[model samples]
Target: MKFLKSGLEALDEVTVIALGSNMAGGYPSSEALLEAALARFPGARLPVLARSGWWRSAAWPDPGEPEYRNGVALVETSLRPRAVLEALFSIERGFGRTRGAANAPRTLDLDLIACGREVIDAPGLVLPHPRAHERLFVMGPLAEIAPGWVHPTLGRSAAELVVTATVGADAIPI
Candidate 1:
C-alpha cells in the first residue's frame, strides 16, 4: 500500500473509477447527474485528481434501455478498497440509484476499475474490476485520463486495452 503525504499514514492505493448513468426519471438529466456525482466525490472523502470527458454509449447487453453517459475519474484517498466501494455505493444512493435486476437501468453507477497495481480478490470487492479491460465503457474513459496505466494482472496498458476492446465501438463524445 502506498501512502501519500496528505497528512494520512498507510493510505491505500490511488484508484481509477468509472461513472455512468442511464436513468433520468425523478432526477436531473443523466449527464447532469454524472457531473453532480463527480463533484460530490471530494465531500465524500474521495478527492478526484483527474477526470475524463463524458461519453455517450448504448446500454450494454441491452440496448432496449436508455442510453448511458459515462466517464472515468482518478482519485487519491487513504481509504481501503472496500471502504472506497462503500463510499461509491453511498454516492449512488445519494443520486437515487436502487439495487434491482442485474444490469437493469440505473440512476447512477460507480465502479472502482483499478487501484494502482493492487490485485484484490476478496468476497465482495475485486481489484482492477475483473472486466474493466474487456469493457469499452471502462477503458475508453480510463485511457483518456491514464493511458499508460498498466493492468496489474493483464500486463496491458489502458491505451492498449482500449484498442482491443470489442465493445464500446459505438461510444461517442458527449
Candidate 2:
C-alpha cells in the first residue's frame, strides 16, 4: 500500500461512488443537495478526483416517486473498505437520509461502486456495487468520469455496462 505524507499507509485506493437524491425533505433542491454532499467528501478524508454532471432518472421500482438527480464521483482515500462504507453512511445521514424501505426516496444516497481492483463480499459492504451494472443511472454517470473503469466482479468496462443497462433508459443528462 502507498503511504501518505503523514506516514500513514494511504488507502491509495481509487473508489467510484454513485450519488443520487430525490426528495429533498428539508434540504435544498435534490441536485443542490447532491452537490453539497459531494463537497463534504474532501473534508471527510475522501478527495474527489473527478465527477460527472448530474443526470435525471425516474425512481426505480416506484416510478411514481420523484425523479432522482444522479452523478458519479471518483475519489481517493486511505481508509479501509469498511471505514469508507461508514463514511458514506455518515454522509448520507448528515443529509437527512433515513433507513426505512429499500429503494425508498430520500434526501441523499451514496453507493460505493468500486474500490481499486478489490472484490469485497462482506456482510455490510459489497465492492463494485452489486447492481451497478444494471442501473443506467449509475452506469451513465460512471461512464462519464471513468468509461474505461473495469468492474472487478463483472469484468466489463463502465462504457460497456452502460450499453447493456436495462433499467436506465430514462436517465437523461441534466
Candidate 3:
C-alpha cells in the first residue's frame, strides 16, 4: 500500500492491519503488541482507538489449527509502506514469529499495507490489502479510527465495507 507523507495529504488516507497470534510459543496478546508498537513509534499518532481484542475467522491458506484472535489497527505514520512493513516483521520476529509456511498460524502476525490514499501494487505488498473490503478483522478496527476515511480505489468507507463484508460475528472482545 502507498502512503502520503504530508499530514495534509494523509488527512484522508486510512491504514488498516490484521492482528493475530497462534503460532509457536504462542503470539503476544493484543495489548502487549499495541504497547510494543507505541514504544517503537514514540511520536507517532495512532488511530483514535484501534479496534482489537479477539475474533475467530477461517484460517487462510492454512487451516485446522486453533481459530485466530483477530483485530485491526489504525495508524498514522510518516514511514513509507515498505518501511513500515519491515518494522512489523521485525516486531514479529522479536515475539518469536517464524515463517513456517504461507498462512501458517504465528506467534505474532502483522500484515501491513492494508489500505491507503493511493492504490499501490508492489512486489512485497499490495494496496487495499487485496482483501480489506472482504475481511472484517481489518475493516473493523479501521472503522474505529477512520470511519469517514475513503478507500482510494473503491471510494468506500471502512465501516461500509466491513458491514457488507462476509465475516463471522463470533469474533468477540477478549
Among these predictions, the greatest lDDT belongs to 2
lDDT tens digits, residue span 1-174, model 2: 111222112222568889999987666688888888988998888898778899999888889999999988878888887888889999999988888999988999999888887888989888868888999999998777677777787878788999999886899888
- Please count the clashing residue pairs in each candidate, in the order shown: 0, 1, 2
The lDDT of each candidate is: 0.81, 0.83, 0.60
lDDT of 3 by residue, 24-88 (tens): 35325545554454444333333422444445565664457756666566565666777767777
Q: What are the per-residue Cα lDDT tens digits for candidate 1 across 1-174?
A: 111233212113458889999987565688888888988999988998778888999987899889999988878888888888999999999988899888889999999987777889999899979887887888888777667777888988788999888776788766
- Where is the poorest 10-residue window by lDDT in model 2? 1-10
Question: Which ten residues in a row are the worst by lDDT in model 1?
Answer: 1-10
| TM-score per candidate, chains pooled | 0.89, 0.90, 0.72
Two-way lDDT contest, 2 vs 3, winner: 2
Candidate 2 residue spans exceeding 4 A from truth: 1-13
Question: Top TM-score: which candidate number?
Answer: 2
List candidate 1 segments past 4 Å from native: 1-13
